[model samples]
Target: MMTCIVIDDEPLARSLLAQHIADVPFLEHRGSFKNALLAADFLSKNQVDVLFLDIQMPKLTGIDFLKSLQHPPKVIFTTAYREYAVESYELQAHDYLLKPITFERFFTAVSRLQVATPKVIETPIPETATTPEHIFVHVNKKHIKVILEDVTYIESIKDYLKIHTTKETLVIKERISHFIEQLPNPPFIRVHRSYIVNRDHITAFTQQDIEIGDIEIPIGGTYKEEVLNILKAP
Candidate 1:
């Protein structure tokens, strides 16, 4: 079992991560701290396998704290900001999870740490059978239910996202990358840094862009290879 701890300045964030760690079968929750300093003291004495750490904090940032350690445990940075993604990976962080994290995304990250064990391999479930059909987004002080099948594409606007569905467009305070975690990948794919399109809604595509109805979304150069490969596959 991997022993883990959460270190975040937000009480709610810490609580949420602790709960997620508890829900996972392979992870054991060791402790939760409000700051990296408190966690550093605990780490001096105990052996921790992983750390769910927040990037922005009061005195010391998560990145700085990890740099100070001579032998730091594998860290998974949890924060609201996406700017530090490159630096986090440079630190050899196990994962970088955005705020408003869902259980599905959290599980996907932690499952990478699971040890391989010989077992009967089972056939994968079909997308129609297993893909989540809907997601609730906090909008207008209410949790609005959005049918995944209705979403044509998602566009990033500053710190918010404009979710365009067949029925209407809903703007919400969330990062597109963070919101993508709630949707399954086969039907939902990020074609650009600012956009994610549902393959089901895509009517046509080229080397540079994709067409969904009358709307045309650019395929970012960085994402071009993977996007073409997935779209071209049988």
Candidate 2:
């Protein structure tokens, strides 16, 4: 269970969050505080995975309090004010909730936290200057050596994925879902329901398409925002 703490000056706000916490099976509400100081003390004495924070308080606001913590836990800011939205995200907060938070919104935030949670993989990746440039994959039950730099993109063919290299597009029988996780981040990103491309190899991008080599692939609408952010990173 994720140990959680609620910090709000108002009693009604604290009570509401406590009720919400009880609904989420995995969340264990430790206590509620009227100010950041009391919450800070509780945090020092115990462990907390998530913090339900209110931005406006008498002495010190939630934003200032959070900034004070050397190592703050995953925070979901709750406030009546809308101005703090961008500021909260800049702090890498889990979610931002406008006061009078509904059960559905709380549930959505919790679900998002699950995806964003950091996992310590047992098989550590080798320390290197660059992501793997060469790897091996079994294709048609035969072990095939592949150079990453030569790969233009990948396409999910139902259960299997076809890895496209400059010389050849090899059909690998491995599940697309599993292969996606194994693929390195950044340069390789899923741009559509069936396509993942090498960002470095991309020649041009538009609202509808991305150009890799001479091959043009349609960018899915759902992935557009993230794809645009990735493309803009350079």
Candidate 3:
């Protein structure tokens, strides 16, 4: 079972989340706190599998508290503000739930957490084995295998992602955040909120945009530093 804690100043919100936790068979509710400071203290002494954190709180805001952690647990941000969504993703939050959260929505978020969690393979790898060169994605009720080397870029369109390969573009109904976690690093890097480009395909780049073939993708302000570092790496 996955152990979790709720950190929110609102009494009603805490109570409601506690009830939801009890309803989930795979989730064990460890504790609930009214502030980030209290939660930090508890976290220092113990570890949990997941954290349901509020974005805004007195003394220390949730975002600031999360940033302070050297090794943070999987976090699901529970907040009333929609503006914090982008920042939450930048922090690699497991999920974001808006205030007045329903049981259905909460379930969906946890379900995603379960799916995103990496599984361990006990089978041993051969000494000469190499990493898989392709990834399979579900599209139109069929699993389509994509060559990693051929992918030029990925574009997020609402709830779906457009995977642009050397041959063609495939539209898959999946979140960009999900792809970010699943895709291999090095060649793939998120340049913008809506774009993930293959560094191998990048013929040119600037502080403002990245050029892959003839398509120029904007570099988000928040992602500039990481993008530049990756591009400059030897």
Candidate 4:
């Protein structure tokens, strides 16, 4: 699911927008806030795929709020007036959803997000149809066999993950974010600013950190909530 948050002041505006988001099956509201500063702090601490922003806030205009981000996500500007429409697009907003946002328009913006999302290809093996164990990665001029369960974690070093398995760690050059597409979910979760861990391998954990073998990985501040929920879930 794509994590999202709404930044708007009016109670009625939030009520209406909340209904529109609820209509989308994939979106889950992380939370909502009235102040841009608070929103900025939340964005810094969390991984947000989409931002539903309102332009005419008191301290910070939505335009200025986005302009300040180092790496902005898909934005949908919400406001009463249309003067900011062209300027909003110039800022690379996915879509400008006018206030009193209709369900149809909201779906349109989400559909664009689907287009921008990365793609993956998976092939089923014969006997392992139910329990696929191995995957092949081309590294150092040869096809290597990696038992997925043996992997401890994957760390991003700019372009590639130094794939740390029980036997060895391979430095295969690929998109860190894109390469993550190849990994199976569930047993693994991206838990830090630059690391993903095999949840099954977690030996111990704390409110501040997790332990796997000799490694003590610190969780990102924003990812704490989901990490805790995953740990608590049956």
Candidate 5:
């Protein structure tokens, strides 16, 4: 079993993470602390496998705290901020989670600690049943229905996402990664950190970028190889 801890300034955040740890069969909740300073002392005394850390704490931010540790454990950053995403990944963070964590997302992050190749837990379907064709997203003040085939691409704008479709562009307050989890893979693929393109709508492509009609989206360096492989697949 892997021993873990939650370090967040907010009491509610700490409590929520601790509860998540409890739910995971392999994770043993060692303790929960309100600050990184308190967790520092605990780390010195104990053996921790994972840390569910919050970025915007009072005394020392989560990024600084991880840098200070000579032998830090696998860390999963939990915060509302999207700006620190690059820095956290640079530090080799296990995963990054945005605020108001859902149990599904939380489980996905923590599951990585146990497996090298993590997968989405799929529910077995009956032979006659069909997959969903559309998804409802919260846009403006109401749930908007968007057909899967209608979406051309999705762009990340800070904490919000701009979903471009054949008919309209719908703006929604959500993380691009979280939003992508709802869509099927073959038709929808992430081309860059800031963009997810529908392969069916892709008109053209080069090693550096992909073109969907007139708009061109740059392929991220790290994702280029995989993106090209998918695009070239028969």
Candidate 6:
């Protein structure tokens, strides 16, 4: 279960979120606050997994409050303004929900939180064994196993990632960095800031871009030399 709190100035909004939280079987609504200050104070003494926060408020805004925390919980911004969407993602918010949030949208955001939440594997690891060749990605609340060898590339879209595999494309609300950590070297290389291509899938390459299965991926200026070196290696 994920413990959560709502920080919104509007009473109706708070009530709605509280109700929504109650409806979700995996979510536990801890408390609701009128402002970020109160929420911050409460957070100091409590352990929370998710925060449903409003963008605009008196005393301190949700964005400012989130910045104040040295280590903030997974935040799902709840606001009426759409302009704050980019800024919210820049802060690595789990998800953003515009005002008048419906149950479906709320459920989607919470589902993402569940998928992104790191799980501890109790089994001990063998030191000599190499990293696994596949990973399990959460999509639509389900964990789907994906083989790294079958992946053509990965694309970043705002708060989500599109995993392009040989068979299909899987979309998930996760960071590219997360995949980079899982994908082993040599086969997977970050060719661009918004893309990571599988080296084994590459059909052709130039200094500026790489061609993989009829798709051409641009090579970022920073990654050019490394990409060329890797591809040209004997």
Top TM-score: which candidate number?
3
Residue 10's lDDT within candidate 2 is 97
Candidate 1 matches the true fold with a TM-score of: 0.53
Score residue 179 of candidate 4 by CA lDDT.
49
Q: For model 6, how does the per-residue alpha-carbon lDDT over 1-234 read when each residue is reduced to its tens digit?
A: 889999999999999999999999999999999999899889899989999999999989999999899889889999999999767765667778988999999999888678767675678867887857889999888999999899999998865899999999999987764456567887898887678999889999988999997899999775687789999998
Between candidates 2 and 5, the TM-score winner: 5
- Where is model 2 poorest over a 10-residue stretch in terms of lDDT? 174-183
User: Which regions of candidate 6 deviate over 4 angstroms?
Assistant: 120-131, 136-234
What candidate 3 gets wrong by more than 4 Å, as runs, is 120-129
Q: lDDT at 115 for candidate 5? A: 63
lDDT against true structure, model 4: 0.79
Candidates' C-alpha lDDT:
0.86, 0.83, 0.91, 0.79, 0.86, 0.87
Question: Candidate 5: worst 10 consecutive residues by lDDT?
Answer: 112-121
Estimate the Cα RMSD of every predicted model relative to the unseen true structure.
9.8, 10.3, 2.6, 12.1, 8.3, 6.8
Candidate 6, overall lDDT?
A: 0.87
lDDT of 5 at 161: 92
Better of 2 and 6 by TM-score: 6
Q: Total clashing residue pairs per candidate?
A: 0, 0, 0, 1, 0, 0
Stretches of model 1 off by over 4 angstroms after superposition: 1-128
The residue-by-residue lDDT of candidate 2 on 34-144, one tens digit each, is 999999888888888899999999899999999899889889999999998766754557778987899999998877675555565678666765777778899777888
Instruction: For candidate 5, give the lDDT of residue 178.
Output: 59
For all predicted structures, in order, the TM-scores are 0.53, 0.55, 0.85, 0.51, 0.59, 0.64
Q: What's model 6's lDDT at 181?
A: 53
Over 120-213, each residue of candidate 4 has an lDDT whose tens digit, in order, gives 4366546744544777887989988899899998887755678889899988875344445467777777776567888889898888888899
Per TM-score, what order, best first? 3, 6, 5, 2, 1, 4
